[model samples]
Target: MNLPFNLSPWRTKLRLRSEAKAQVTARGSSRKKAPIKLGLPIFMMIVAVLCGLIMGLGSIQYAILIVAIIVAPLVLLMQSTTLIAWLLVVSMIVAGCLQYFARVEQAHWMPFLILAVMLARVPLDAMRAAKPGERSDGVDLLGFLLIAFVVLVFASALVNKNPPMQALVGVKQYVFPLALTAAVTLAVAPREFWLKVWRSIPWFLIAQLPLCLYQYLFVEKGTSTAFGATGIAWDAVVGSFGGNPEGGGASGALALFLCFGIASNLALLRSQQISPRLAWLSNAAAMASIFLAEVKVVVIFLPLALLILNRAKVLKSAVSAAAWLLATLAFVVGLLLVYQVLHYSNKQTGSKSLSEIFEFATKAEQDTYTYNRETGELSRTGALKTWSQENIGRGRLVESLVGYGPAASKGFSSMFGKGTVARKYVFQLQTSSASTVLWDLGVVGGGLVAAIFVLAFVRSLSLAKRLAADPPLSALAESCAVAIALTGSGYLYNNASVNVSSVQLLASLAIGMVFVLTRFAKKQAFLPAVSSQVKVVKRQVFRPRIGT
Candidate 1:
C-alpha cells in the first residue's frame, strides 16, 4: 500500500507524462479525422461548383473564367514538363491577336488571366514541396517592399497640398498589396511553372500579330472614345504603336514579347527533343510582331537576346555574333523605312515632309536659336528645365521630391499660361520616355527607388544565367527577364506608377518573382543542419535509384 519515498515523485511524473501523451494522441486523431470527414470534400465541392459556374457561362465569360481557373494549376505544373509552358506561349499569341484587332481590353485580360493562373499554381506547388525549415525569403522581401510603399504613400500625403492624397492612398493600397501577393506567390512556384509562363510568350505575340495588322490596316484613321464611354477628340492615329513619335505605343510590349519568344525558340532549337517546326513557327511569329510593332528601341532587345542566347550556349559564338549583326542592321533599316513612310504619308496628306518633321521634332533647337538671336545667350535647355520655368516652379524640387500630393497636379498647370499641357507632364518629362519615377520622386527619390528596382532585375538576370546551364527553366527565365526589361524602359514617360498599363504590371510581377527566386535559391545553397538532414531524408524517399 506504500510506495518508496523516491518512487512516489517518479510515479507522479509518469502519470503526468501519460496524460500529456493521451492528449497529444487525441489531438492527432481529431486532426486526421477532421480533414477526411469535412475539409477535403468541402474543398472539392467548392472547386466543382466554381468549375460548373465557369462552364455554364457564355463562351466569352466561360473562356475568361476557365483561364482564371486553370492559371494556378498550370503554374504548379510548370516543373513537370515543357507542355504547359508551350500552352502559355499560344495563349500569349492569341491575346496579342485580340489586341491587334481592337479588342484592347480583352487582349489585356486574356494573357493576364493565363499568367495569373500559372502564377497561382506556383504557391500550391511550393507549399506541397516546401520543408518546415525552408522558409520563402522572397515573401519576406515582398512584404518589406509593400510596407515601404505604404509608408511612402502616407509620407507623400502629409507633405503635399492636395487633399485628395487619400484617393491616391487607396490606389497604392490596392495595387501594391495585390502586386506583393502575386509576386510572393509566384516566387515560390516550381521551376516548371516559370517555364510554362515563358512558353506562353510566343503565343501571346502570335495572338497580338493579327490585332496589330488590323489596327494598321483599318483602325489607323479612326479614333475611339477613351475609357470606353467619354467622348473626346483624338486627332493622333498612332496605330498599334502606343506613343512614340514613330509609332511605338504598344511597340515596347510587342518587342519585349518577341525578344523573349525569339530567345526561347533559339534555345529550343538546340534541343533535339523539340520539333523544328515549332521552333520555326515561334521565331517567325516573334519576328513578325517586332516588325509590325515598329518600335526603334525594340532593336535593342535583339543584341540583349543574343547575348543571353550565347551565354546560355543556345547558339555558337559565330552564329550568335552574325545573327546579332544582321538583327542590328535590319533594325536600323526598319527604322529608316518607318521614317520614310511617315515622311511620304505626311507629304501626301499635305502635311510636312521629312525635313518638316525633323524641324518639328527639333523645335526646341530652333527655339533656342531664336532666343539666342534675340537675347545673345542660350535659354535654359532641356524639356524639364523649360517646363520648370514655364510652370513657375509649381513642380518645384520639394514638390518633385514629395510628389504634388495626388489630385493637385492631376490637371494641367494653370500658372504656366499654357492652358492644359496634359497632367502627364506633372509626373513625366514631356520629351523623355513617359515615366513617373523621375517626375514623382524627382532625381533622388526616383534614383533610390530605381536602384532597388534594378537590384531586383540584376538578381533575376544572374539567376537566369545560372539556370541557363539547366536548359528547361533557364530559357524561360531569361526570356521573361528580357521581356520585362524591355518593357520597363518604355515606362520612363508613361506614369507606370499609376498601374494603368497591364504590361507594366506584368513586368513588375515578373521582376518580383525573379527577386523571390533569387533569394530562395541563395538560401537553399546555405541550408541549416536540420534542413540538410530533412533534405537527405526527402531525397532518399523521393529519388530511389533503379534496382534499389
Candidate 2:
C-alpha cells in the first residue's frame, strides 16, 4: 500500500493525548456554563455550624467538625492539586495549635478530613486530563497494599463488633495516612508543583522556632487544662504542635519534627542544594527545640535517619564520609549538652553525665515491661507485655486474631456505654503505636500495615535510583525512603502513628510525593524509548528510495 505517512506506530499515544485535551476543554466549558451557586452551600454552612453548636454545646471539637464540613466540599470542587498540597503542609504545621486553642481531643481531624477529600477526588481524576504515562505508573501495587490494609481495618472492626464511632476514630489514626498514597498516586501533577510543596517545609520548620521559644520562656509547664485534655503538659515548647497554655505541650511530636528537620537539612547540605550556613542555622534551631522539648527519642531516631539518608552518597566519597561523621558527632554532643543543661536544676538526674543519663534512660525503658499499677502509665514495653498477658497468656485466640474491637485499645475514656480493653486494664494503650495496632486490629491488620510500609519503602528506593539524573527528585525520593523507615520505627518508639502526630503526617506527605514522582519517572522512561522506536520506523518507511 502507498501511504503518505505511517500513523500506526504513534496512533494510540496521539489519540490518548487528544482525548485528554478534549475532556479538559469540555469540563472547563461545563464549569463556565454552570457556575457554582453559593446559596445552597451557604445554607449548608449555617446548618453545619448550628449542628456543631448543639452537638458539643459550642465546644471547639464540634466547631472543627463544622469547619471540616464547610471546607472539604469546597476544596474538592476547586480541584487544585497545588491547593491540596499546601493545605496538607499548612495543616501539619498548625493543626496542633488549632487543637490546643480549640481544646479539641485527638490529633486535629482537619488533616484527615483534607486527606479524605483527596481520596474522594481520585474517581474524578479519571474525568480530568492526565499527562503521558500517568494513567498507569507502577503505583498500582502500592495502592492495592493500602486498600488491603484498610479492608483489614474494617473487617477487624466488623468481626469484633466494634462501636461505629470508636472504629472510625481508630481508622483515622491507623489508616488515613496509608490511604494518602492511593490519593496521590492518581492525583498527579507537574514536578514543579510537588517541589514547591517540599520547599515550603523548611520555612514551616523555621516558623516553629519562635513559638517554641515563647512556650519555653513564658508558659508555666503543666498538663493541658483545656476542656477535653487535662493530662500531660501538652503546650510547653510544642511550637505549632499546640496544647494548653499552662501545659508542657506535644514534646514528643515536636521532637519528631525536629529530628526530621535536622535530617532533611543535613541531606540538602550533603547534596549541595542549600548553603552550609543555612543548613547549620536550621539544624541549630531544630537542636535547640529538641532541648526545650526534652524528648530523649531524638537521641536514637536522628542518628538512624542520617545513616539511612546519606549512606549511599557517603560511601562513594571519602570527603562526604568525613563531613557526615563530623556532623553526626557535633549533633550528638550538642544534643546531649543542651539536654543536660536544661535538666540541671532537676534533683533526680540534674548532675548526671551524658553517659549516665543514657544509662538511666536505657534502664528505665527496659524496666517498663511490668505494668506499674501505681502510676498507670503504659510505656511501649509495658503495652506489649500487657497485650501478651491478656491475649496469649489467657489463650484468647479469637481476640488475638481479630482483636477485642476497633478503638478497644485506645486510652480515651469511653464515649459509648461499654467497657473497652484500655478501660478494663486501666492502662494507656495509646502510648505505643505498635501495641495499639496489635491489640486493636490484631495479627492480620498489623501485618498488613507493616507490609504497606515495607512496600512503600522498597518502591521509593527503586524510584530514587530511577531518578538519579534528576538530583532534586532523587534526593526527595531517598528522603521519603528514610521517612518511611522512621515512621515504621516510630511504632516501636511511641504512639506517633496512633496519635496522628506531626511525624506521621510528615511521613505521609513524603510517601505521597514519592508515589507522584513514580508516575513522573515512568513518563520519562517512556519518552526516550518512543523516540528511538520512531527513528527506526522512519528508516523502514523511507529507506533510501532505491532509485535515488
Candidate 3:
C-alpha cells in the first residue's frame, strides 16, 4: 500500500514514525492555535442590546432566551468548558464593580448568564456527542427527582398565577447551579485543564485577602463605595462581593467561600493531593479573610465542615498528622484573633476580655436562629415557623401541597404585583434557604430537593473511592460531597445557594465533576484500551522533539 514511499521494513518504520510525529505536532499546535470562540456570546450580547433598544425591554434583562442561544454553540465548539467555568468564577470577584461602579443594570445576572450557558451547553453537547442507536445519557434517579422539583416549581407558579418573570427570578438563585451541574456532567475537558482550574481556586481565595484587608483598614464602616455597602455592619470587609451603594454586602457569603476554601485545601492536603506548603498558604489566606470579615458563623461552619470531610488518611502518616495538627492550631489562633476583631467591631464602650468575646459570639450565633415570642423578633427559626403556618393555617390545602408559587419568598420586591405570599408573609423572605424553598415549593418539592442532596453526597463519596488513582478527580468528588453537606447545613443558616454566587457556582461545579467521573467510568467500561493508548500517546507526545 505504501510502495510509493518505500518497500523495506526499516524504511517503512522510519516513515511511520515521522508521520506519527507530524500528527502529534499538528494536534499540539492546533490546541495552541486560538482561544475558544467568543463570537457566540458576543453576538448574543449584541442581539440583547438591540432588543433592548427596539422593544424597550430594559437593558438590565434581555431575558433568558438570548443567553441560552449564545451558550449552546460555545460549549459544542470549545475544546474545553474550563474557560466558561472561569468566566463565571472571575466575574463573581468583580461583580460588585460591574453592579455599582459601572452601573450595569443586570450585573447580578452573571450567574444566570453562566447558567443559561450551562443549560444550553448540556443538551447541545449530549445531542452532538451521542452516537446514533447508542445509549443516551439517560436521566438517573437523581435527575428525575430534580426534574420533578422543577416541575413543581413551574406548577406552583402556574397554579398561583404568578408572573413568569418573577417566577424565573425567584427560583434562579436556588436552582441555577443544579442546572449547571447537568451541563458540567456532560461537558468534556482535558484532565490537565480541570487540574489547573482546581489549583487556581486557592489563588482566587488569596486574591480576596488584599481587597479584604484594604476594606478593613481604609474603608470607614459607614462610608458607601464601589467595593461594598459600608453602612451595613461588617459590610466594609466583604472582599469582592460588592452590593448596593446604600447598604448591602455579602459578608456572610464571603466567609462561607473562604471557609469552603480552607476545607478544600485541608481535604486535599489530608489526601496528599496537594503539597503541605501550598495547602498551608491557601489556608492562611482563607483564615486571614475570615479574620478581616468577622462573619461570626465561620467559627461554627468551618470546624463543622472540616469535621464532616475528615478522612482516615490524615492519621495514616506522621507527616499527615503533623500537618493536620498545625492546621488545627493555625485555625484556632486565627479564630482567636478574629474574636478580638469581632469584639472591637461591636464598638463596646468597656474593655471586653477574650472570654467575653467568646460569649458574645455564642450569643450572636444563637440569636441568628432564635425566635423570641415576647420581642416578636423574626430570626431564621421564626421565619420557618411563619412559613409553615402561612399555607396550612389558612386551610389552603392545594397551596400547602405545592406552595404559593415559584419566587413566592424571594427577598427583593418584585416588579410583578406583590402577590399573596409577599403581601402576607414578607418578613420571611430574607430568612434561610430552607424556609424559602418550603414557602415557594411546598413540602413535596422541598423533600425532593433534600433527597437529591443526600443522594448526590452518597454517590459522590463512592465515586471518590473508585477514582483513587486520579487524585485531583477523587479530591473533586470528595470536595463536592463536602460541599453538598455544607450546603445542606447552610439551608438552616442563610440562602447560600440563592444569594451567594460563589457557593452556588462552585458547589454546582463540584457536583457536576462528580457526575463527570461517573461518565468517565462508563466510557472506560466501553473503551478501556482506547483510554490507555490515549494516555500513552499523551505521554509520548510531550517528549523533547528535536526536529518537529
Candidate 4:
C-alpha cells in the first residue's frame, strides 16, 4: 500500500465522510417536514368560532343551501360506493319535509315516490354492487315469521268477510316488510354514514319541538279530530289534544323524545372523536326539552333509564340513582305548581277552581278503577286484550289464507264497500281498520297473525338486548329497538300499521334501520381494534430510548 502512494486509505475516508453528511441532511429535512401540532385550547377556540358562525346564520333554507354546497360534492365524490346511503339520506330529508308540511292524505305519495326513485337506481347501482352474503340466517328466519303472520291475519280477514282486509295486507306485507328490509340494508353501510344519520336525528327532533309546543299550548282544541285538527270549542290548555286533551298520548311522545335524547347523549359521550363539552351541551338540551314535553309517563320510565345507564356502566349506579330520584321528585313538584297556577287562573275566570278540577280528576280515576275492579274489566290494558280476542283468532282459517282473494264480497259495508253483504257487515261491525282485521279474517287467521307479530317483537327485543351488552352496539341498537317496540305497542289499538301516511312510513323506516343496524353491530369490532392498535403504536413510539 505504501508503494501505491497510500491513495486507498484517503479514498475510503472521503467516502465515509460523504455518507455521514448525506444521512445528516436527510434527517434534518425530515425534521423540517414534520407536521406542526396546534395547542388544544387554540384548536377548540377556532372550532367554537366556526360553530357560532354557522348557528348564527341558521335558517333551514340557509342550512340546506350550505349543506348542498358542502355535502353534495362530498356525496358525489363517494357516489360509487355510497350512492345508496346518499339516497336514503335524501329520502329522509324529503320525508321530514312532508311530515312537517303535508296533510296526512298527501303524505302517502312521498314514500311511494321515494321508493320509485330507489327502484330506478337499483338496476344500475344497488343490484350491481357486489352483494354482501345473505344477511344473518336469523334475519331470514325473522322475515319468514313476519310473512307467515301477515298471511295468517289476511286469512282470518277473508274468513270473517272483513272488507278492510286489503288495508291490512298492504301494511303487514308491503309497507312493514319493505321498511324493515330498508332499515337492515342501510345499517350494513359504513359506520361513518350511519353516524352522520344519527347526528341529524336530534336536530330533526328539535325542529319539531317548537311546532309541537305551539300545538300543545295554542292550536289544539279540546275535542279530537282527524289529523290533529282543532275543533270549534277550545278546552283546557294541555298541549297537543287541545280541548279533550290526550295528555297520555302527548306524554307518550315526550317520553319517546326523552328516550331518543338520552340515547343520543350516551352516544356522544362515548365518542372519542367528539368534544366533551359538546356532548354535555347536547345532553343538557335533550333533558331540558324532555322536561318541557311534560309527559307524565316519564315519571315511570326515568328510573328505568337510570337503571339502564347504570347497567351499561356509563354512570355510577349509586350516583345516577340518587340523581334520578331527585330529578323525578323535582319534576313532580314542578308539574304540581304549574297545574295549580292553571287551575287558579281558570277559577278566577269564573270556571271551576284548581281544587275542584283535582277533585274531579280524582273522582274520574276512582270511577275508572272501581269499574275495572268490579267488572274484571281490563281498563287501559283492555285495548290489547280486546284486539287479541276479537281479531287474532279469525286469521287461522283456510279460505282466508291467501288474503280472502282481494276485493271479494264480504259482510257489512259502507259507501266504501264492495257488495251488499260487505255493506251489512261493515255497518254491523263498525268495520274500522282495527276491527276489520278480525271481522274479515276470523279467529284462526287473526291468531296466526298475532303470533307472527309476537314473534317479531320477541326477535327485535332479543336482538336489542344482545346488542345492548356490547359497548359498541348499545347506543344505536337500544334506542332503535325501544322505539320500534313503543310504536308497535301503539299499533295494537291505533291502526298506525295499516295507514300509509308519510309520518307512519318515516317512523317505520327509522325502526327498520335500527333493526338492521343492530344486527350488523354484532359483526363490527373495527373501532375497538383500531383503538387498541393506536394505543400500542403510541406506546412503542413514545417508549424511552435506551440512551437518550
Candidate 5:
C-alpha cells in the first residue's frame, strides 16, 4: 500500500543506522588491541639496572640480576604450585646459612634475591585485574609502616658518626630483609603457598636441629660453638663441655626465635587439624628442642604463649574447672622442667646456681665481666644498669635526637681502640637495645621502629581473637602473632639479633605471614560454605591440534 518514495526513505535511514554501529565497533576493537605502554617500563628497567650497578654489583652481576627480576614473574606464572611452594623453605635455609658463608655485611644481600623475585611481579599484579577465584596483592598498612621504617633507617644512617663507608654498609642490611613483607604481599598467589610457608617453618627448625646438636657436642668437646645459647651458658643446649661458650654474652641469644617455633607447634597442636598422635608428638619434640636450647627468655615466654592461645577454651561456659586446673598444673610442670635443666646444666658449666646468677644480674659492679666459674661462661651483666648509669651519668641519651648514627657505638673504633666499651658494646654509651636505639636512630626513627613492633603485636592479638571460632585459620594467626611479638627480643640488649642471620630471616617471614594471613582470613570469611570433603578435579589442558 506504501508509495515507492516512502519505502526508499525508510531503507535509507536503516542503512545509515547500520553504518554508525559499524563505525563504533571498529573504534572499540582498535582500543582493545592497543599495546600496553612499553615506553615507560623499558625506561624504568634500564634505570633499575644502572642503579644496581651503582649500588655495587659488577656489570655482570647487574645483568644477571636484571634477567632474574624480569623472568621471575613469568616463571611464577608457568611453574606448578608445588615448586613455588618450596621456594620459601629453600630461601630460609639459605638465609640461615648466610652466617657461615658471608660476613654480616655480605649476609643481607641474600634476602634481596627474594625481593627481586617479588618485585618483578608488581607491574603484572597492578595491570592484570584479578580473575575470579584468583588471589592478588595490594598495598596495605603494613606495607606503609615498612616503607616508613626503611626511610627512617636510611635518614638515621646519614647522620651517624660511623665511617661513611661503614654506615652506608649498615644501612643496606637494615633495608634488605624488609623486602620479604613486600614480596609476600605482592608476589604470592593462592592460599596453599602460605600454608606451605607455615609448614616450611617446622622443616626449617628440623634442618637446624642437627646443626644445633652438632654444635652442642662441639660445646661438649670444649670446641668453639657457633652462636647464641652456646655463647651464653656453654652447656645450654647439650651440656657443658670443658670449654666456655664463646662470643658477646647477651648479644648472641636466640631465645626469641626458638620461642617462635615453640609457639607455632603449640598452635598446630591446639587446633587439632592434624592427626592427634602426630600433633602431640611434634609439639612435644618442638618443646623439648626449645627447652633444650636453654634460652631463659623462651622458658618464660613459651608457657605464656600457651596460656594466651588457650584462653578461648578456658573461657567457654561448657568447659569445666578441672580443665583450668589441669592447664595450671601443666604450666607449673613445664616451669619445673626448665628449672631442673638449668640447674643441671649450671653445675657442669661451672656457673653459680640460679640464686647466685640472680645476685650477679641484680647487683651493679663497675661495668666488669661477671665470671661464673661454675658455668665457665662470661655474663653480659648489668646491661640495663650500665644503660641507666650512662643515661643518668652524662645525659647523653637525653640529648640524642637523630642519634649518633647507625653503628655509632662502633664509630668510636676510628677514634678509640677496639677494646673500649663503645666498640665492645656496639653503642656510644648504652649497652641495652633501648640505649642502642636512642644512640643510633634517636626518637624520630627509633620511635617508628618501636611503633611498628607494637602494632604488629597488637594486630596479631586482634586477628587471633577474631579468628578464634575457625580452628585452622585461628591457629595460623595466633601462631604468627605469638612469633612476631616475641621478636621484640631483638630489641632486648644489643644489635646481635639484628645482625644475626637466622633471627632476621625468621622475623621477616613471621611478620610477612601474619599480614598475608590476615588478608586470606578476610577473603575466606565471605566465601560460601562448602562440604568437608572436596572433590578434586584433575586439570586437563586442551591444546589445539597443530596439524588441524
Candidate 6:
C-alpha cells in the first residue's frame, strides 16, 4: 500500500507535477468519456408503473414516490459512494424508528435504497482499485451458497397459493442481511476505508440507542398505538424490531449487538485508534442496554461473549457485567415494588393487583413451554409448536426432510389444535433461522447452513488469534470472532442475528474488516499509498528548473 519511494513534501513540486501530467495526458490520449444511458431503464420502469396502475394494483403511486425519493438522491450523490453507503445505513437503521414515530405506512423500501447504493458502488470501487492492479474481493463461495438458499426460498414461495406475496416478502427480508456481506466483500478496500467502517459502528450505536430508549420511555405512553411497532399494547417496552406484547420490543437483542460493538471499541482502544472516553461511554451504554431492554437471550449471551473475549483486565469487564446485572435486577424490583405499593385489586384472579405489564411478559415467556414437575417433561408452544405440528409432528418423510417451503409453514399453524393447550402452541408458523433451514430447506439446506457455520467459525477464530499478536488488528480480529460466535448461536434463534438489514450491515462490515485485517496482519501501523506507474512517469517529465 506504500509508495516505492518518498516524494518531497513540497506542495509546489506536487502541483507542478500534477499540471505537467495533465497537459501530457490531454495531448496523448484520444479516449473519450462514455455517456451514461439511463433512459431505457427509466422508460421501462415507467411502463411497469403504468401497467400496474392499469391492472388494478392499487395505483402504486406511493410505491413510485418511494422509489423516486430513494433513486433521485442516489443519482445526485453517485460520486460520493462512501457517503451514500453511510446514508443508506442510517436510513435502514432509522426507517423502523421513523415508521414508529411518524406512523409511516411502509419503511421497508429503505433497505432497497441500501442495496441500490451497494450495487452502484461496485463499479466505482472497482475503478479506484484498478489503478493499483487490484481486483475485487470477488463473491466468496459462501455468498454463492447463501444466494442459492434465497433462490430456493423465493422459488418455493412463488409457487405457493397462500398469499404468495407475503411469503416472498418474508423471504426477501432474509436477503438484505446477506446482501450486506456481498456489498462489503465487493467494495471495501484500503486501510482507511476499512477503518472508517470499523469506527462507524460506535457512531451507529450512539445515534440509534438513545432514540430507542426515548421511544421505550416517554414515547410508549402517549397513545394506544405502540411508538416503534404495531401491537405493543399499553405499557409494553418499546422493542419495535422484535416487538411482542412484552420483552420490550427487541432491545435486548440490540443490546447484545452493542456488546459486540464494545468488543471493537476495546480493540481500537488497544491500538490507540479511538479516544478512551468514547470507548468507555459506548461500553457503558452497551451495559445499560441489558437493563433498559429485558430479554433472556441477552442474559445468556452477554457473559459468554465477555468470557470469550477474556480481556487482560478481567476485573473491569466483570464489574461492567455485574453493574448490568444489578441494574436489571433493580429495574425488576422497582417494577414489582411499585405495583405492590399501588395495591389495586382485581376481582377475577385470586391474586391482588397483578400488573398487566408483568402478566404479558410472564405469559409470553411461559406460553410456549410447559414444564411438568412430576415427569420432568416440557411441552412446547409458540413458534416451536407451529414447526412441530405442521413440519415435524405430522409431515411426511419427504416434506419433513425438505420442508413445506418458506412461509408455507405459516399455513400449517393457521388453526387452533384440538384443545386449548394444543391450539396455543399452534398459533403461528414462527420459527428460527436454524429451524427454517432445517425444516424448510430440508437436508440440502441443513448441509449448507452447517458448512457456513463450520467454515466461518474456524476461519474467524484462526484469524483472530493470529491478528491478536498485534494491537490494531486485535480490535478487528476480536470483532470478527464475536460475530462468528453470534452467527453460530443464531442457528437456534433467528433474532435477526444475520436476518435483518441493520444487524446484517454490521455483521457484513465485520466480515469485510476481517478480510482487510488479514492482509495487513503483522505489518506496520501505516503504509504510504503510491500512485499508478503512469502518473509517476508523467510527473517526472515536468520537472521545473530551480534557478527561477
Best by TM-score: 2
Better-scoring candidate (TM-score), 2 or 6: 2
- Model 6 lDDT, residue 168, Cα: 47
What TM-score, over all chains together, does every model reach? 0.58, 0.79, 0.74, 0.53, 0.63, 0.63
In Å, residue 463's CA in model 5 sits off its true spot by 2.6
Worst 10 residues of 1 by lDDT: 229-238
lDDT per residue for candidate 1 within 1-548, as digits (tens), equals: 67456687788999999999999999898884444468667876776677667657634555556545644554545552342343334333444444443444444454445444544454565566567986544544534664565465556556653345333433342233244334444444565555545555445545556655544433342233322322211212223323322222454455555676677676655643246776777677666555545444555667666665565443557776677677668876766566457323543346545556557545744463333332222322344454446443764667556554332333222122211223443332333332233334345444445554565556667776666445654554555466555555544423323333345545555665665556555554556656989999999899968985
For 68-152, candidate 5 gives per-residue lDDT tens digits of 6665655657433333344454444554344332223233344555544544544664445346777656656766787887776
| Whole-model lDDT values for every prediction | 0.49, 0.70, 0.69, 0.45, 0.54, 0.54
Give the residue spans of candidate 4 off by over 4 A. Answer: 1-105, 112-140, 153-177, 186-188, 216-255, 272-295, 298-309, 312-472, 489-515, 518-548
lDDT of 4 by residue, 175-232 (tens): 3435334433543366566566566555544444454455434433323453455432
Q: At residue 422, give the lDDT of candidate 5.
A: 54
RMSD per prediction, one decimal? Answer: 16.4, 12.0, 11.1, 14.6, 16.4, 13.0
Candidate 5 root-mean-square deviation in Å: 16.4
Worst 10 residues of 5 by lDDT: 239-248
> TM-score for model 3?
0.74
Residue 138, candidate 4: Cα error in Å is 7.2
Clash pairs for candidate 6: 2-528, 239-248, 239-249, 239-250, 368-381, 417-423
- Badly placed stretches (over 4 Å) of model 2 are 1-67, 80-83, 101-107, 126-139, 220-235, 245-247, 266-280, 313-330, 346-357, 368-375, 413-419, 538-548
Candidate 3: residue 178 Cα off by (Å): 2.9
Off by over 4 Å in 3: 1-83, 100-105, 220-232, 269-276, 313-337, 342-377, 414-420, 522-548
